[model samples]
Target: MSRGAQVGVATVYRRFPIKEALLTEAFAEERDRTLQLLLDLVRRAQEAGALRRDFVLEDVGLALMANAGIRAQSPEVRAEASRRFAA
Candidate 1:
């Protein structure tokens, strides 16, 4: 992976003791950024009266939990499930 990224393997290993550790950190950082963006959008929606004032991050987390199951479906089913889920 480091070679594909054009970085030295030693440099990658120096920062992350194991490849799994590196992937875990990367995914976590991405998840945090996405959550922040979602929170901002939810806040703006609530301010505009589009979303209920009482809605919270836990509600979004629940929605995400439901959405995760959609990935197990076939592609066509997944697409339809995702559309309905978003709705």
Candidate 2:
């Protein structure tokens, strides 16, 4: 997770119309890029026998949701949680 995730998520949840429109496009493009990158990494892992060939994109979504569930009392704490989560 990124350090700015707390702020970003808060912004998303607030749903300001103008900001939402811009953020929507920005996040959509970023999501596409991230998805592709993940797909590539998964493919590489499969080729290296680190992951099963049957692994699919839906599994990635589940993993991401699990990661996003992390929370903490402070930004610093949350950042630490994210780092540990990535590890």
Q: Give all candidates' CA lDDT scores.
A: 0.86, 0.80
For candidate 1, the lDDT comes to: 0.86
- Candidate 1 lDDT over 1-87, as tens digits, reads 565778888878998999899999879988999999999999999999998899998998788788887774478888788789877
- The residue pairs that clash in candidate 1, if any, are none
Model 1 residue 68 lDDT score: 82
Kindly provide the TM-score of model 2 when superposed on the true structure, using C-alpha atoms. 0.49
| Candidate 1: Cα lDDT at 26 | 79
Q: Using Cα atoms with residue i matched to residue i, what is each candidate's TM-score against the true structure?
A: 0.57, 0.49
Best by lDDT: 1
lDDT of 2 by residue, 1-87 (tens): 237555575566466457768677778988899989989999999999998899898987776887789888988998898778665
